[model samples]
Target: MTSGDVSLETVTAAKAGDRKALEDVLAGLQDRIYSLAMRVLVNPDDAGEATQEILIQILTKLSTFRGESALSTWAYQIAVRHILNARKLRDRDLGLTFEMFATDLETGLVADPPAAPDQALLLNELRISCTMAMLLCLTLELRLAYVLGDVFEMDHAEASRILELTPAAYRKRLSRARAEVIAFTSQHCGLVSNQAKCSCPRRLPAALKSGRIRSGSYPNSAGASVDYAAAKQQIASVVDDLKTFKLQQAVPGQMCPEDIRGRLTRMLSHPL
Candidate 1:
């Protein structure tokens, strides 16, 4: 995704019908594309499907690589468009609002910790799962902005180009999205807000009984973990609103699903 000459060379080689070049280029993009799709759809199955489709489109349209943008930007443009279309066909609404969630916070939700050490291990797993799932409440557009800006650490100007918005417009959207996520998490997530009573342990039992968290495939934060005390201090800082978003972003939830790259690569080998 770095700028300058290497990107152009890769695109040029891939376009010129170097099979290895095409494979290598696609290998690099598969996970990033899948990650974006997962944020949009909040389902690994859907994200995998979308990633394969997007990869095919990018490969087939390589000749149109105009160099006006980085290949990553161009690829993301295709990805954003495809994901938008897919979302229209899928369920795109969360039906819950920050206002609704804010109201829920007043009830003081809490859970009893598991007595056994084995269950304690599972509790950690649930924390990450719930953290990732919380993102599903955001509208697809706002979620996309947050993922692009905060999670992926993309700059506003480039993110604007990817989302096809003016830089100022993109900033406005990202700011609003960041604020909503921060406010909700601060009031509802135990890790983000120490005073908040809602912790993953409280929800783990229900999630397990419902078959949401399976046996071998334990959920994880995917990126680094943030200490609750540190996060709490950051949330209380002067610029806490913005700082909270960055802290949460530091704890990324997941990347692509397992075997996605292999599945797509095999599928690609056969035909269009």
Candidate 2:
């Protein structure tokens, strides 16, 4: 079915209490819903729970929907509110002050290495993940503005309506969010540069003269025999660890603070 037809059908079935139709609607929109939840919650587990809650809310409240907006938009509204509430609960449960999370993120970035020239692809993925994690710490108003405007590429007027804020208010929130993200990226870039300077081997020319440079068609003087598969596996592990860290942060209830700390310690002990 075309999107419009499917939407209309879902609405009709939803109004008639057809559970399968509701499921179909949710299944069709799961990616968008999950992406929004993940962007706001910054943890898979929390995002998963938030997704479930949002789906339930959509089903229960389907009858109340005035049809003033598209079903997708209305569902998005519900998802956004659910994420906001989940974040609040997570913060309260962990006894975490927003300042603490922000400080930790700042400190983590400082200690992180710069993007490797050869690892540019992996680094870009990490950068996107870091940006999403940062979004989790933003206020709901700002988070919605950023996700809708920046991530989803929504127009200011549309975002304003979704956020139920004046265009000026939305603009302010978008401005703040953009500024925060840019500042974070700038700091991160500095950290990466410093790390590369410190850790990267010095005197590639001298190394080549000494026959220490490996025979590789690739640049960066890496040996052709370099275990790219192993290296990739290691990077994947680190990404997984980071994902777990994000999940812990997003859903603290899933793991005790001590458990989270231990996991982080182990991850750090093993260098990326």
Q: For model 1, give the 10-residue run with minimal summed lDDT.
A: 104-113
Clashes of each: 0, 1
Off by over 4 Å in 2: 1-5, 86-125, 190-272
Per-candidate TM equals 0.81, 0.58
What is the alpha-carbon RMSD of candidate 2 to the true structure? 14.3
Best by TM-score: 1
Global Cα RMSD, each model? 3.5, 14.3
Model 1 lDDT tens row, 1-272: 44232366677777887766777778767777877876666556667778878988888887888888787888899998887777543564557666675454334334554543455446555655555556767777787888899888899888999999999999999988888888887777765667766665565555566676654455453343654344445545635466556555545445655576676566556544
- Model 1 lDDT at residue 197: 66
Cα error of candidate 2 at position 95, Å: 9.4
Residues 1-272, model 2: lDDT tens digits: 33423477777775776656665665555556766776666665666666666766766687887777667777787877676666554574433333554454443222344334545333223333433555655666676787787777778876787777899998999888766654443333222233222111222323233443332322221222223333333333444224223222221112112332333334333322
